[model samples]
Target: MITVVLPTRDSAARLVHVLPLLVPAAVDGLVKAVVFADAGSTDATLAIAEDSGARVVQAAGDAGARLSAGCAAARSAWILALGEDLVLPDAWRTPVEAHLAGGGGKPAFIAAPGPLGLAGRPLAVLASGEAVTAAGGFKAGGDPLKALLGRLRPRAVRLRI
Candidate 1:
């Protein structure tokens, strides 16, 4: 099972769009849990998260720190760290499952679909590691390419809508 971790601070509007996309994964048992490491929100972000069955943790710090905290709280062996504005593609389950089952220790980046049939930008990265060290070295301000290169095996997987 995998846990989807995201950091939110007054992200109610964004979650409205994102939560729906994640529900299917949860219902299908691919996503065991959703962790929202919130820094602080005056809005209904927490309310929405609870309503969606996500475990909300009190997180304090920058985006990277919040992400790390959320990841640390995850119960799954694999973790998918996603941006607030991103959404998983309809066909995400197959590829994700394949990657996990393939025993690829290297991290995989989910690509966002671009205009028309063009390539999209990398959105999220999935990895397997220790409770507090999953997706190693790819911190908020770290160099993604360098981190990927440092790994024993690196593979980039794109998720197109």
Candidate 2:
């Protein structure tokens, strides 16, 4: 099982598009929980997250700190750290399940679609709980997620979307 961590800042609109896509995975037991790492959103983000049964944690600092806070609260052995707006493809489970079943050591990132692929932007980060903890939870400044990805030397989990 995996715990999804979404870092939010007035991301209510985006979550609307993202959350529904995870329902099948959650129902099928692939996703055990969802943690919302919010950076003090002034919108209905928290309310919606709470209504949708997501645990909301007030996260301060940068993106890395917020993600750390979310991952720290996760209950599953695998962590799926995602951007709020990056809606995953329907076939995402294939690669994710493959990664988990193969014994996740190094982390993996899902390649985004269109021109903003894996090289152009930060996308979904899939890693084992041990891998995340070993990285000391993401750095505070700069591109912490990217730094963590590079440090782990993650394999690419290509999605067919």
Candidate 3:
């Protein structure tokens, strides 16, 4: 079972779109139970989650904190911290399960809010049930054409299509 921990603040609308895509037990016994940790949302975020059978936790503070709280609520062995602003994919279930089950690696996937490098296979990096790119070493700084460089990690270079 893969516990997908989604962190949100005022994300009611987006959750509605993201929720339905995670069902039907696509990867054998791999159940995708959702945990929505709301950062003191005044909107209908919790309600949306409740209606969708998601476990909701009342949270406080930033994205990382909310994600941490949600991950703490997760019951699965592998925890996936996702953003509320994003819509997760349904097709990813099979690939992630297959990748993790390989047992040949300890995967950590970090994703930016953009396309990955051409040399990097998208599914291998994004759908490996690992952390996303941003969690790896990249940062998004408002420059649409480039990733902000992090000194302690991989150098960020502007990629051209």
Candidate 4:
């Protein structure tokens, strides 16, 4: 089982687009839970998250801090962190299950063709055990590369398209 963490600040519009895409994963049991680390959003983001059965964590800092808090609040051994605007492909479950079964320590990211077509890319990212530990140890806006390389050896897994 895996938990999905989404860090957001006034991202209701984006959530509307992304949350629905996540529901199927949750229903399929691939996602055990969804946590939204909110950074003082006065908009409908909180309401939307609540309505979707997502646990809300009060986060007050930069993106990295919010992400860390969310990951810390996760209950599953595997955690998937995602941007509010990203949407995973229909075939995402296969590679995620494969990674989990493979017992690889490297973090995996969905392959994107380019910057212009980010939405067309896969949305799932399987955060390894090392990556989760690194996230908790870093501060707000901390460099991700440092986390990936500092505590443990770095080897990134990319989900093929």
Please report the candidate that would top TM-score against the real structure. Answer: 2
For each candidate in the order shown, give its overall lDDT on alpha carbons. 0.70, 0.78, 0.53, 0.71
User: How do these models rank on lDDT, best leading?
Assistant: 2, 4, 1, 3
lDDT of 2 by residue, 1-161 (tens): 89999888898888888889888889999999999999999999999888989999999877788888899899998899885464566677887777777743557877555574434445688888888888676767876666777767635344343
Ranking by TM-score: 2, 4, 1, 3
Query: Considering every candidate listed, which one attains the maximal lDDT?
Result: 2
Candidate 3, 1-161: lDDT as tens digits: 67777777888778777666666652445656778878877799878877878898876866556665666677766655554454455465555555557634444333343545433321112222333323432222332111212231242222221
| lDDT winner, 1 or 3 | 1
Tell me the tens digit of each residue's lDDT in model 4 across 1-56.
88888878998877877777677878989889989989999999899988999999
How does candidate 4 fare on TM-score? 0.79
Steric overlap count per candidate: 0, 0, 9, 0
- Candidates 3 and 4, the one with greater lDDT: 4
Q: On residues 1-161, what C-alpha lDDT tens digit does candidate 1 reach at each position?
A: 88988878998987887778778878888899999989898899999987888999888866666777788888898788776454556667777777778745556767766788775655566776452263364355453322442452435444343
Cα RMSDs, all models:
3.4, 2.5, 6.8, 3.8
Query: Any runs in candidate 4 off by more than 4 Å, and if so which?
Result: 84-91, 103-105, 115-124, 129-131, 134-138, 142-153
Residue 115 displacement in candidate 4 (angstroms): 8.3
